[model samples]
Target: MKYQDLKAGIRSHLEDAAEDFFMVGYFLRQISENALFTEDGYKSIWEFAKGEYGLSTSSASRFMAINARFSIDGGEHMAEKYIGMGVSKLQEMLGLPDEELEKVTQETTVREIRAMKKRQEAPRSFYGFPKTERPEGSLLTTPGCGDGKYDCFSCCRECAIRQEPRHCRTAPLGNPFPCTRVNNEEWKKNIAYSLYKDECQLLHPELAPVREGDKEPDPCCLNCTNKTCFNRCDVAKKKDEDEKKQSQEELRKQQREAEAKRPEPSDRDIKAFYDWAGIKTTDNITAEDLKKRYKNAGGGGGRGAALQDYTGSARGIRINHKKELTWVQIAKRIKEIQEAEKKKADFVERSNGAQKNVRDLIKQQEEKRRIEAEEKKAARAAAKLQAEAEEPGKPEIIDGDFREVEDEPMDDPAQEAAKTRDERQEPEPVLCDTCEHEGECAGKKTHENGCMGYEEKAQELEAEAEPNPEEYARFDVESILKKEKGYLDGGREADCPAKFIKEHKILVDALTLLLEKMDAEGGAED
Candidate 1:
């Protein structure tokens, strides 16, 4: 047939099929799935047909094609090249009650879909080809509330509200992010607050910060079909979850790297920790005590030790002897061994205990620290008074004319606090700590990034509270140019939102990771 004639037939078929709603949807979905012209584009096959070939992909048929359609040509399918096989059959084969389908189709409640299934066997009397009986030993196939009646009007999805998949927390047995509406129910936007507050959640991967209560947007509460709308929303809850997980993983990795780089514990902290454990020094502690200290220090398990080399975990009991002992038996043995050890150690410790009561010793140490702290405070006060007395007479060492700090203004408390915090946060950069230059750590040949003379740099910093106008302007221009390159004024089309993007990314990443582990990264999808 000519393309124009074919298009007419399809459009006519669709118009005629409107009387039968099932056929209309069947036509729409088939056209949607298989009819697009380009491999990648928003246009559907039906849309492509209308545009490119001047063809129409819609259908008008004498039969609803709800279950099965027989063709006159033997072993022949419908005239059009067939790509999809099960859709029509699957719909007809579905044994869901009319009431249930109606509820699912129009009301948007997906709870009923949970128990009902698409792949399972149909009831014996369901109207379809090659009907089979329910299993002989089956418990029951009781119909849900008002499940028997099926009306043609409310069967198609267009008659009802639109719900995005991410809007509802509950998805059906195998499906993700389906509607949570009910059957023949009044279409109230808000039901029980619980429906939204607890049940409806977004599906994004943004990091959610720790908060005392629900920190998600309250405005998200009222307007919902409870449809999953992760794709459209910028700040989906799932995206927050994903971001947090990613940030946590990054933090863990960064911490691992940092810990690897970190210098070993200082002598003071190590000694303090050992003392707190009631050990004289870390070197004096036993392997078991070391294990305890490691646990307290937030360490976990590793290999190379024998299975029994380690002490019993916090929740386990030690076995004094090599035997198959029950937990109770092990506990009893441990207690007995511990009591014996205590008795043996007591003899030596009791003599030492009299010489210096542990508590009294600690108290004496604390008192000495307090006295030292008071002395330091008094010395600081005396020095401040002397500095004030000498302030008037001395020729200032700080050269006022070559001021590194601004001469115009004194500091604001708020600004000073902010500056102090910023200073604390900045990672120390690679700079030469030593320089012989006079004015600043400037234009000099040195091994360390020419950043030597930090003391000179410090002096310059003290002088220059306000930057030179021309210098600041030049720096600002470069920063703005770099930012412009990173993004378009508007966002990119392909740059899927992090939330929906994360959903797809996580799924694809999981698939890739799984494939790699399975040694099937290059293999075809199953």
Candidate 2:
């Protein structure tokens, strides 16, 4: 058939299918709404459709939704304009607005319609404010009210009224409007009061009372007359200023007490302390250097005594003394501590050296004793050998006959000859060297005797010496090409014979080239 005719026929069939889908959706809607499935001995429309027409639950739901969205004349018929569009395109267009539906045409694809719908429904800026900053219950976008107004404040008030049924604390029992009374203390304690105060400050800034020193009206100022008046108010402002001044004075008093309790040393005090302590000063004298000097002095005292002195009349030396000492007294204490530590360190060092000397003396004595024991053992062995060498043959009674048994010396010629022969012979190979049971084998006797593992290893070595038939079969180019050619010939009746033959020939050529490259590589290796 000609291509245009074929395309026309397919298009017509697609339009007919679209019409059938719409009618199906309309009929399913009617059946579901009326519970007409009960007449067919089914509990629900889903069961009836599944049993009679093989429609699944999800498919039935989609059909019902489509009918509800695109049906005309109370779902008696579908809109004729959507008949040519496929079911998938119509379903994608369902999310689009009524006005946007006009943009869809016969050429519009399902994916394009889906994208358009997504763009339309994408979340907008929350009422011209960031989503995080938007108030709870506030509309995401501006919505028209019954009176054709788009004021957010009014809408928020209405939303608040609907969500919270409580009346204001000062309002009459049945009053529906919000309480406008502003109390600064209440603003801190009550959420509704704070929100109302903020709303008034933001929306009606002109009505806020101004203070004397403020260049512009303070939006954060407390309201006194229910946001109705804008008179200059200074009583609250004056009281707040006085409280602030009092707090500052109290803070300064605390700082002074702390300073008096823990005073910092001046430059003169530091110099005097260092001089009395007999410590040299430099531009870069770190705490670490001081610590090293203290260690070298062998200082032995608690930290409190090293850094402080007692001024109490009852004490020659006080434990846990506070900072009652002057700089000179502190330096004197530090010098005494350093001298005591130095003496202690010196005594400890001398004691350690004496202990080391004693240990060395003990080690030398043990070595002398050990040498004497070894020498005695060697002398005894030599005496035994000499006695054996001097001894003659002794007669022994054996089996009713007198026999002579000769004693062998440590340096016997016969034993020496046997040792020489052993040294001259080459070592035997380990029986388990090539055995599979190597580590677990009993011994050389087991390996040499009737071990099946040894036999198997020998056989494996022999097999390795010969070429593998399976390996040759795997790389046999002629056999592989013949098998592939047979497959191509067999499939020729199912597909175009010429096309099959061409593809088979191309595969054969690729295989041949691969084999030739492999042969070249092998030859280079050889």
Candidate 3:
């Protein structure tokens, strides 16, 4: 026949038998076994299933596997009975024994065969071991002592290892050996040779027996503890304490190497932190406080121990976690702090000089203000004394007070008291000076009773005689305050403040020493 005519006939038959499982299996078996599709103008059998047949790849593969299993059994009648079965049912029927296969073939439908197969294959438990079966008479008797009867078959019924193997001896009645039972005689011989050779002596002591015709015919040497004996039992030696110590040391060294590889804090970051904290040494700062500042500065989370260790302490700061460090940062921060400390004395001296300048400026300003006030008081006193010293005249009043004509100024009693040391000195008086009743004076200059100038001269004499105690008190307070201002300007160097600074420095040094001691102890521990 022509190839086109033959192909058309085959395709029409395939379409008609599309739902027929028997024809599907038959064709799938022929295609797979002979590679018939690849021989007939197709690249592969999968492509042939896609193009020529309407079956999926998985369905085609199942049909092929089921057909191959039946062909191996060489049973045409058996294959015919299962050919009508679905691909899944036929696959389950394959490789089953004749009894199981016959039972599955009696199932008229695919669902019935699947259910029967599932029941047959499903185990009661995951382990598939027989439960609740008692040992047979052979297993009930115990074997001879140390005679290599460790196998569960030769063990007594009371043995713990006689679990599932009891089914082997008890299941098939009247048979000397049941099919379930494995012949362990060959396994025993092989394992016995290895144990007697001392390779498995720790596991099986029965194989290490002292046989007959030996000088010392003991079955076992479990309790022999002779030190100098020529023939002693050889055993595995326990590990030495020195070797354990070496291993621990090596582990610590590995940890140190790992810690050393961690990323370091930059010099810029360290200096910025020191400037913010207002302290020169990071060693004085606790790990937790540093972490707080670090987080506040957007430095993120960590133990902050690496930053601490960067101060070149013997031990890394122990915080919430023992953070790793790099050697470079440790060296960098140490150098930076040392240089800063060296320049600290110069910095303090400059600071003191600047304070002195500020104090001098304040003192000059106060002195200028005091001078200006004294000048104003002098001008007011000169004007008032000149008015009182004016000659008698018709009063030219302004703001209800007499105005004096321009004249030579009169002597002030208070100014005279300041100039002269003598308190009993009285000033010479002018007769009826600025008095309205001067025309009625008979002996007004000399008379004490009726003269107004006589009364003023007497008052000036009394003022010269008396001492003002309040003026001296004001002078003493001003002197004390000036001294205090000087001390403050010198940065409180003369007072208890200097002592406090010294004591605080001593405390800081003591704490630094304590921290160093702790670091040394921790490093020793590590």
Candidate 4:
């Protein structure tokens, strides 16, 4: 094939691919809308596309979006108008408005369409003028050009050429033109006057100047030499006079309406005013005197009334002077003030009482903590004393003096040997003195076979002699004694003294027996 044919073939394939992409988007939209993918054991169309066709979620979503945007009948089918436009152009045209979209053709490049869209979305200048250069209080509703269309540059040009005669020759050619008036030297450099001059010459060739235009033109060009045409113009003077007269007439009408609405003072108000002024009676009170009194009370002469200042019990109270209040209104306001004050006073008293209660509770808690700390200190001291008393061979405090008790002297080895020999030489067995069968037994004959009665008695003694470790582990003697002491000191267990004593005795006996057993075992090991 020729190179041109190859290019043509590639273009054809691209258009076909775009059409195929549109079809895929249409099918995806169908699957998503009808949930058809659920029948194929897929949770969603995106999941189904990814699993079956290896399509990414983003690509699937883009395809669906393109179908929704460009397809006919809400993605049921593709529109024939966009058949050969290709996907790239369609994507770029997504943000274009309907009017701008209609302007796009197959020949229109994506960049041109994008630029057009940006220009349309860009903000227009404020009334064809820069924000900083706009005049304060200028009318925002000024008419546009003679064609009634709001082109920013055209509107500004029309304003300069028609409304402002001074800026006609120097008006700039863009939107947001400078509002400052140009001097003669700057005007000569301005290009707007050249364009205006050319237009004037084209329209009015007969009036075109040979070289120089008028140095100082009149308002009406007919009187070119006269500089005071504006001052002498009857039409302009009449318009100004008419506007002034209308303004004055409106002001007078407003004043008349306001005067009609003004309320007259009643007999009650007059009496109250007299009382407020400290006058004896209203018999001799002149109108001048009443007016003076009202003015002194912050009343105004006309519509611009000042606020009235109250005196006596309602010192800080102020009411509008324009309002014609009777004595009843003033009295009611004073009563409200007094009631509010009473409530505030009650709240303050309650706050003070609450503070006092909090202080008292804090004092009581501090006292309780101090007493508990003292009790704990006393308990530690008592435990120390009890431990010292139980310890063997320790010095005892007698009359505030420590006195060490001397150890018992050890027996001589010779003496111990002699004692043992003496005991062994005795022929007769020792009598079972504490046995119950003592009176009935034949002394040595009954003891020959280890004396069953004596043996029974010995077993009873052995059973009682064995030390029980469980008893020592069961009772924490010092802790129990401290708790009992605390109860006695606090007067909590007054009626339970016998129970305390019994438990104390059992703990002490068990502790003493455990110590003695431990000492005996040490001696045996030695």
Candidate 5:
């Protein structure tokens, strides 16, 4: 197939590739520590066997293969060929909407990624590495070329052409091998020179400098790929090209307009660092993207507001070409974040409602994560889809292409949500005044594998404690009444411990029952 077609296929396959990585990476990550120890997400078959399903490291490696090979048809390894074509770290190249996050599974967390990075169980025999780290094919020659021995004669001359633009002339035949190579008189030559000579570059060979299934290096680099180099540029020629292209893109246009709308960072107050993506990076993220990620985290799909989000700006952020963000200024910014976080903590401590809302969200998030992990585990095991879930095989579409509109304002909606979750109107868990038992009345399993003895425990604990459980329940009502009024009248403080508060309802209930019995007796006499 043609190279262009292969490139297009690579792009399409990447959508599948990321999911595959998540699947394989997650499984590899899981068995590393306590996977077998947790029965919750394990297969029911594994559970009944009561075995660890223990495997040696080599055997553990096969787990990813087993899952990757999963299919309704059973043994079809569908991902084999497309994975053979090679995947790209193109996901890293794209600028994220500041307001967005992918619909991530539990496997996407940093902790899981940390485990996967230790070793990749990639079967070198099947799929190739995702990042070839380059794009160009052939000798990577250019239209305007020169040749020299000490350095690439091609580069020496390009440097000449750049430094002396008047001296260079366009090749009618279109430049020879490595035609696209820029003249960098100072920058060191790459591996192309240390190994293959003019036979490749001078001759313009058809085969990629790879032979007999050997991996090929990408020619797409800082100088060769003129589009990305900016301040980190080594040569004058590529730098000029980088800036010229940057001004034209529609993305930059929106960026410039949006940045203009917000107050520009003062040189003193708003810190700037080297752009890690090279100079082509505008050091800007769209307000639209951040909101999208935030919404995704909330399990919603809606276009983010066009308003500004100053949350975590990566612009002026210095990261390597690998996009590894490492800079002192970013660290400084993180400290500022910590301080701001402290203020939020203080506010939460002051406001009961805020703390409760945060707690509810945490509970909801944990519940969502538990359900997600269970589904993924089921998918890996090639089990039938769970009836409780929508299914685990949905395609991941994270881009802003699909978004629903919400008419409500963010502030009002947030307030309403906070009130709903944090309002203190609901009753707390019921405790039996008749017992000192923890946990729901033993109708529910303690997960100890026996018939629940909830009533027995309640009565036993009640027999041990002072005051009848029935009287304790009534005391709670009066205590709560006095305590609530104390906030207004400032007369007496009702010291009701959490233990008593919980146990009180049982007493009140019992007293009411006794009174009802006495009334029944009176009615019978009449």
Candidate 6:
């Protein structure tokens, strides 16, 4: 077959096989072992996984490793040993040989397998030595085999730990190799030293450096629980002393900065302090003196003390209090203050509500009194109008018909008597009776005067007469009494005795009738 046809067919088969994890692992093993993708211009399996198959390098590598361990001689089908096992279980058991893994059951978990493996890999002796040689693909890398002569070069120059000598790990843990300097020249000078001391002393103590007096010295400082050698080692002791001195210097520097930032005491604070000490002073006291007095009195000794003392004295008061706040305590204090403010606000609101209620009640009572007063006034007015309407002899129709006419001067008795008889007798129709101004004036000579023009007077009399049942019921009793008195005192003005006698007889009859009615009503009541 042509190379292109073969390649296409293989790609097609790979696409199908890559669907499952184990199948993909099988394909990966085949592709990597034969370097099949190299012909397609891919450099390695990682390139093939990324460029062609679209798989991550980590995922592809993991599949390939699993295929090698789970399959029989890297076969297409997974071995019966771990067919139903989880991927993680298989990864953990990968260190075991195929024969040993085949004995494991599907019921076994990954954690149990890992624990079993850890136990198997544990040191068998009490000297903390590994049960086996280091694994081929270990993560740990000990440069120059922990030799002190190894040159750190550019890597160490940029290292923060190297810049700060206090951060060096060897100061506390101690060096592993015989060479004491920054380089491993002492181990290189003796070829046997390099070969023997290649491993950590804790694991293989036979290769450790020899001491003068002790038959068997400690392999590593970390293994020594007593730590008695910390004082004996000159390097550890000197580093410890340097660290303590540096820490003290740093503490002093911080204190100096804080003291510089501290504010000067105010005038009130100065006066209060002087007063408390029973010393007469004023606001002119120097800041230096105040600070001295504050410090002597234990100022800045603890939190919240820079502003005031514990005894509620305002002596050492400062602008800012040196108090450290924790969130829990701040929240608790804030809640307490909020509750107090809420209580105060509620009290004010309730007081205002009560006042408003009282004002509203008073307003309602005043309105009620006003309404009652208005009702009473209206009732009294209505009663007075009713009494006026019921009064007898009250004028209803005053169209001037009942008014006395003005008399003309009369020296002759016969002419006066004729005029009086005409006036006192029944009304006579005038020759100009049809005149529009007729009856406007009460005088009999209205015709001769062409009728006085009194239109408004006529209208008022008509309006007043319209509301009553008896519009013309007025007796004009006062005019009749005046007439009688005039007749008794100066005789008749016109000498009409019959008319005067008739009026006297009418008055006597009316009084007798009124008396009889009153007597009858009184008897009925009794």
State candidate 3's TM-score. 0.25
> Which residue pairs in candidate 4 have backbone atoms (N, alpha carbon, C) closer than 3 angstroms, thus clashing?
none
Error of 4 at 447 (Å): 45
lDDT of 4 by residue, 1-526 (tens): 3333432443453366655666667667666667667776886666677776777666676676787878787745667767688778887777665667788887899899778766874322322222223357865644333233332222222233233223232345453333232223453344244434322222222222332342211122222223233322343355556767999999989866874575654333433433444554214444344444443354312333222333222222123322344444544443443444455455446545755876797689668766766776677679889999888896676778557999565489755655667778844334544463434454444443344576776675564343332353323444444543443333222233355457556655665565456566662321
Q: After superposing candidate 5 on the true structure, give the runs of residues whose Cα lies further than 4 Å from its correct spot.
A: 1-167, 170-200, 203-251, 259-526
lDDT of model number 5: 0.36
Clashing pairs in 6: 148-183, 149-183, 149-184, 150-184
Q: Which stretches of candidate 2 lie over 4 Å from their true place?
A: 1-18, 124-526
Flag regions of model 6 displaced more than 4 Å: 1-19, 97-103, 121-526
Better of 2 and 6 by lDDT: 2
What would the TM-scores of all predictions be? 0.20, 0.22, 0.25, 0.22, 0.14, 0.23
Candidate 2 lDDT over 115-208, as tens digits, reads 7856763332212211123357866543332222332222222231122222332345465544232223343344344434333542333334
For candidate 5, the TM-score is 0.14
Candidates' lDDT values, in order?
0.38, 0.51, 0.46, 0.50, 0.36, 0.49
Query: How much lDDT does candidate 3 score?
Result: 0.46
Stretches of candidate 3 exceeding 4 Å from the true structure: 1-65, 72-97, 100-273, 276-285, 296-343, 346-526
Lowest lDDT sum, 10 consecutive residues, model 6, at 154-163
On the 0 to 100 scale, the lDDT of residue 100 in model 6 is 47
RMSD of 3: 25.3
In terms of lDDT, model 1 sits at 0.38
lDDT of 6: 0.49
